[model samples]
Target: MNIHKFFANDEIATRPLHHVMRAGIFLSLIIIIFISMSGRPLAQTIEYDLKSVSVLKINLPVSQAVTIVLSDAVSKIVAANAEIADAQPITDKSIYLVGRSFGTTTVNLYSESGAPVGLLAVEVGVNSADISRSIRAALPRSDVKVNTVNGRVQLSGSVNDAYSMEKVLEIVAQYGSPSIVNVITLKGGQ
Candidate 1:
């Protein structure tokens, strides 16, 4: 067969190939447009209430676990520092944060469809038992109670005098926590 005749005869086959290519291009463009208009930003950082214990908080050594309740089902969790902390999914709406080291890290929670649920600012600190013991040893009979809330050292109960209250605060400050709530009341107006 002549080369020119062969090319002419195959023209119908080439037309279908062109049409398929155009369809593929159109589908790709539609997908791109749909993704861009999905309302999910390329770079999203959801800010939650750091002060709320329900959001994110943990203590070192895993003595106690912080449970986070999610509004939606969680399919995956990404810890910024695995050595500092670890997150385990208890269920679709609940997760347990276990502290590994004394440091701060961020935990990213994602949905089953890979949409971000929220970002947790996890602060892993020294164990609350150690902190409480240290405070008691420093101020004996001071009636001070140390508790950890959202990675913050909370000093509650009553103190006998201003000196004792100051000493309790000083001891808690040594831990270098990000926040300290001194809720101790002085007796005798001292």
Candidate 2:
């Protein structure tokens, strides 16, 4: 009877330990699940493909001109969104007239009511040297500089006004689509 009593005590002690172990395992699993869920993204990210939306390739002269003009307007719209993402300000704008002549093109940005905000004119061709010279001529006051590498031109400088940015875009548009627009990416600020 004493041995039987001892066995009963052992069983009682083991049952509590088994329950404690299961509870600990359940708690560990719950903590791991909570940590994993917390690490997931909290807010959905907003994404935009500037190139896909605005970049247009042109070859025919008239088509090139028309497309570039359209693309400029499109770029403004797409760029406005990008600007919003980048924390820049934008307003409704349009181009009254844009024309290309002798590797040079003129661009005019107008407000929604047709009031002009800026005018930019630029020249470009297959020759980086000529394009560089044209940019220098177009932006004589802005210390414009050009870099060409592997069929790409990048323009960097400080322009006195927003017109200079339009001018830079005009230059790039002359070469090709916004994606490969002479490789000339204009960076303007301050």
Candidate 3:
């Protein structure tokens, strides 16, 4: 092996290959730790589906409609639960998701050839502002906060105890089919 190639200078070349490998590995570990502690997201959100990402996420409030323009010509659309949300085609490539009630459901779209095109996760919720206002009043003592982020209830912050947490969740459940992005932290038992 040409050991000189691995070293930048004659002095570094004096180190054995195993020692050099260990140093390189240790440096990599430090770099990784630094990056993770930097408070920036090292990786970006995965573009789940380039074809479906643009149009398939439906975050409609109750008594509202959201128009989705699909890249493919939609021949047929089926909703898993029509009572919660329904789809009406606006065009061959577009549709309106009518929020029928409070809940979460999925709608499958098909192309003209009857091949499945995309699956849309439909969430029908009460207005976020209204839900937030009611939640604050209902739970006056806790530090938890629930927000409808990307059509799902991202429940964060901390509660006094597990019972308080459950009560917060129960209150929030009435608003919609909450996804509950679990991120509660502090909990001291009495």
**Cα lDDT tens digits for candidate 3, 1-190:** 4242354655444556677788899999999999888987532221224273634565677777767766667789899999989988878777777888867899988877888778888777756666567667866766766556555677777777877777777777786654667687656943
Better of 2 and 3 by TM-score: 3
lDDT of 2 by residue, 1-190 (tens): 1111124545733345556668789999999999999998642222223234332221112111221222223223222221111111232322222122223333334444565434333332244555567777887776656544322455665567678767866876676633332332334433
Stretches > 4 Å off in candidate 3: 1-55, 133-143, 147-155, 159-190
Off by over 4 Å in 1: 1-62, 128-130, 141-190
Listed in order, each prediction's TM-score against the native is: 0.43, 0.28, 0.49
In order, candidate lDDTs are: 0.69, 0.42, 0.71
lDDT score of residue 154 within candidate 1: 74
- Runs of candidate 2 exceeding 4 Å displacement: 1-125, 177-190
C-alpha positional error of residue 147 in candidate 1 after TM-score superposition, expressed in Å: 9.1
lDDT string, candidate 1, 1-190, tens digits: 2121125555733345556668789999999999889976433223234234335433443334666666667788999887777878778777777777656788888778987767777766656677779877877787777766655677789888888887877777776766787888998576
Q: For residue 77, give model 2's deviation from the true position in Å.
A: 48
